[model samples]
Target chain A: MMDILSRLNNYTTIVVALGAAVLGMISGVIGSYSVIRKQSLIGDGVSHSALPGVVLAFMMTGNKSTEVLLLGALVAGILAAGFIIGIVKNSRIKFDSALALVMSVFFGTGLVLLSIVQKTPDSAQAGLSRFIFGQVSAILKRDVYIMTIVSAVLILLVILFWKEFKLFSFDPEYAHTLGFKPMRLNLLLMLMTVFTIIIGLQTVGVILMSAMLIAPGVAARQWTDRLWLMIVLSAVFGAGAGVIGAFSSSLAEKLPTGPAIVVVISIIVLISILIAPNRGLISKALRRRKSKKGWLEKGVKGGDII
Target chain B: MNPQLEIQLIAIFIATACALPGVFLVLRKMTMMSDSISHTTLLGIVLAFFIVHDLSSPFLVVGAAAMGVITVWLTESLHKTKLVSEDSSIGIVFPLLFSIAVILISKYAGSVHLDSDSVLEGDLVSAPFYRLELFGVSIGAKYIYISLFYLILNIVLIAVFFKELKVSAFDPMLASVLGFSPILLHYGLMSLVSITAVGAFEAVGSILVIAFMAGPPVTAYLLTDDLKKMLFISGGMGALNAVLGFQLARFFDVSISGAMAVMTGVTFLIVFIFAPQRGLISIALRRKRQKLSFGMLNLLIHLLSHENSEYETREAEHCSLANHLHWHEGYARKIVDKLIIEKLIVVENGILKLTDTGRTYTSNEYSKIFNN
Candidate 1:
């Protein structure tokens, strides 16, 4: 056990990685408000939009500091959010396409900027590529602090706004009549999303960030509609994926840590999506079967079973 | 442009062409099924690859399309068991089928020559380069051509079946009333969706297929009210993004899929912000202008209604513009002033009166309050 601890210390990187995963779950759980608001793809949109911010931050700072780049990423992500809302509210395009639209445009710009980064030669630039695919092993002790602080703030905000998020998610029109501005709530939701995606960027990269933001929340959603519980459960699922994926990648000398972590998250999502006891596809079927059996005894035969 | 970009053009065109059917898919809220078809088709592809010992065989497309249909059928079967939701039926069928295919891939990893990676993310770069020359033009990027064939097939089918698809999408009950079998349209759309997906798989991969299928049509929908225009505009948007996506990919040196996704996003943003009729900026401006006018009119009415002010007095002040006027004030004031000049309001010094013409606006309380 001591040896395992020591070896684990050698990759304190995985702990940071796990922290990001936990951040992901918390964001996802909180993000479910947006998701159920039927704005599920916002995470994907914002994550893609954050790319150019990262690259621009790298260019401006002459460094690849996650904190600096993340700030830039947040700005880009928020702008993308504002733009998406603007499109949906003011124009005729639907929410889904608007999200995809922002995602592609911002990500395209990021790719172009990334190419420019690749062309430049410098020591900091050497590690700049890490943001593209997210090599967890490249994590610094400082990254842990940023991730922890941001995640804690996020969790606290979600806790405080739990009822608001819920009321807003289920029925914004109702909330609006009760003096809550659905637009403000939606903006807050998208802004928090910006922060989460930026924090998770160093661990998951842009393209796969949606997988992190959505997969866990989606998995947790299968378990319960109670927002707080869903969040906590998603955090656990995300953290578990992180720790396990980070460890397994370490086990394989050749496997890259980022992809490994993603695969783990994906696996968890797959399980929860398919077979989680309550929320899983299998469980839903089993629950339906049992209910049908109960109904048969009650003289209620065949229908939607809903 | 590199060979990759050119290949991607073929990929994007085929993708855009195929995505024409996707507009219907997303609108009907069955996107997950499209995703499932993507995964389950892997089983079919692998099945064909093993049977024919050829990755490029045409049989692979047929087998894969069949598997896509089978997935839907199996899901429908699970749904009929009186025991599961449609989502669960989907969730249960695909992974099990996919895992079985994965197991087979591992079992024959050496001789299979078809890995899960290729099946999921079909090496678009190399696959597109596989070609057979024709008469003299050397025109054999067969995957693109095959996808084009499917694309045309889809377009023709959609063109012939426009009313049916529209009726069903708007209201299946209405469609059924009109003697159109929604089930047939549903399956037809699903089948076309499957064929397009399978055809585009070798060129652009599944994720891009989804992006194209959902992205541009949605963009077009934002910009237009007409569905026919939506189909045209969405396909155009997809194709435009493909070209831009290719150039953007080359500019950035990233995955074509990533670039195309970004291009779709950019196009959406532009349309969102500036699409003359449906853009945010325009709508906001229009609303701002309308609100200002409404607020000014409210204030004018309040002032004129005070104690002894006549409507003509208010009209003179409005025309003079001495006070801070709201944006909508002009519109309301003009209408009110026109009423007063025409003898609707009899002004007595600094007083206003509401004649029959002026009183007309207040009659409908519901419409007045709602501003509907």
Candidate 2:
């Protein structure tokens, strides 16, 4: 264990791992609300929409600063969310259809823009494609600092409005009658989700960002029913997956970091679903066997069994 | 055929193939399952290629079909656990399988001609170059032939199992009682979707496959309520979108698949806003018209109910009507003016009285609201 820790002592490896850990924790904490609200796939839509925003930001600024690109992504994500809301509200289209439509169109538009950017003479456009399936080794100290500050702010907001957010998530109509504006709270939650997704783009990329949001919350759900414990466990699971993913990718020769992180998180989810306490598959199977045995023994004692 | 014409033909074939099963998917409210199936099929393709050591094997389609059924089965099983909801289960399963495929392609299959990038955003320009050879001569584009074969298969299956598919989609309990197993139909349709997705994946890529699968059917859904018309219209719309999308791609010098997806969204948007019966514009207009007439009827009812009361005398005055109803003066006056023009009410001795026709109208509306 000590040898493994020392092997991971390289400065870049430590920074990248720390950044991923923070990203995973934030995704888990925020994604719990989305998952509970049954809008788990909304993150998928917002993440895909961020692509066009990133490219448009690059085109307008002619620079590759992460901050500027993510800001553009944030705006685009909000626009996509708005379009989804608009379509679902005004038309006969259901929420899932609206989500799929906006997601595909925004992503297609982004691809068209990316092709244009590739055709341009500027070579700085080279790094922009990395946002598709993130290249986490590109994380510098400054990028980590930015990630830390943004995640800190998001965590603080979530903490500050924890009760209201909980009520809003559990029952919006009840919250509305309690004079806690559900619409505003819903928007605030969306904003936080968009922020988390933007920060995570550099680590997990758009294609797999949604998995980061979903896997941890799902894993944590198996362990407990309390909201606070679920949030805490989800954050820990996410951080664990992130650290493991980053470390493994660094140790291996050809392993890609984003997919590595996703694969690790997926394993955690599978294990949780199979072996975690009362909710696990193994536990349920065992319980069923026990009950069946008890019933058979009772039947034999009553002379009802052959 | 010319390369451009061949590309257009392939696009149309792919569109129709996806749209056929897509209609049932949309009707069943399982659009997201198509998204999951398309992604997980990548795993099947990778595994099949690994086993056969060939990209063009017939077994790849079989593997992909199996994977698609597995995806649906896994999702349903997870849902049955009651721990995870349906969409969350989908989010969990596909990413896991797809990431495995990606990792496998990156780590072990790097030397092969298979590239994940082409799988994601297929290069339709090069699609025409892959010729279908039979015996000693070249026939046509390989992708076009493959897509057309699947399109025909989809049509035949849907035509033969139309009643079963419709019953299962709308009411699975009734379908099962009628001796048509809904679960079997579900897997059959899912397998068809899987095969169509694999056939189209090489030509249009996965994202556009989703667009073609859901978009045309959803647009057609807005146009008609009958399932037969919806199917025909969806297929026609799918072909139309392919041609328009191909032309748009040429005009803009963009990705052909991307253009097609965008065109599908555009057509859906247009139908959403302008469809005669179910469109947003028509619905809004109908709502506004209903509100106006409802307000007028409500005013007449109020007058009829208070025909001999002092409140009627007061409300007979122009501004008093607004005050009594707690409406703005402008709104009250507009309703009153429209009512007078319709001759539903009359001013007599500074009291509002319901005309004979107006009393009948009020009773009709009252019965419509309460008696039903």
Q: What is the C-alpha RMSD of each candidate to the true structure, in Å?
A: 6.9, 2.4
What overall lDDT goes with each candidate model? 0.68, 0.85
Residue-wise C-alpha lDDT for candidate 2, range A1-306, written one tens digit per residue: 786777699888898899889888989999899889888888777887887899999999987877788888999999988888787768777877777778877777777788778888868898675775577777778878888898899999999999999999999999999999877898889889988888888767765688988989999999998999999999999989988998998888788777888899999998999999999999999999999999998988889544
True-vs-predicted CA distance for residue A279, candidate 1, Å:
7.3
Can you tell me the CAPRI class of model 1? Answer: incorrect
- Per-residue error (Å), model 2, residue B16: 1.5
lDDT of 2 by residue, B1-372 (tens): 799999999889989889989999888878878878888888898899999998878898888888998999998988888889878888888888888888898898999877556666776889789998999688888878887898999999999999999999889999999999788998999889988887888787777678888889989989998999999999999999899888998898877887888888899889998999889889989998998888888887777677677665575665577787888888778888888789988777666678899899898988888899
Give interface RMSD for all predictions: 6.5, 1.7
**Model 2, residue B236: what's the lDDT?**
93
- The candidates' DockQ values read 0.19, 0.64
Question: Interface Cα RMSD for candidate 1?
Answer: 6.5
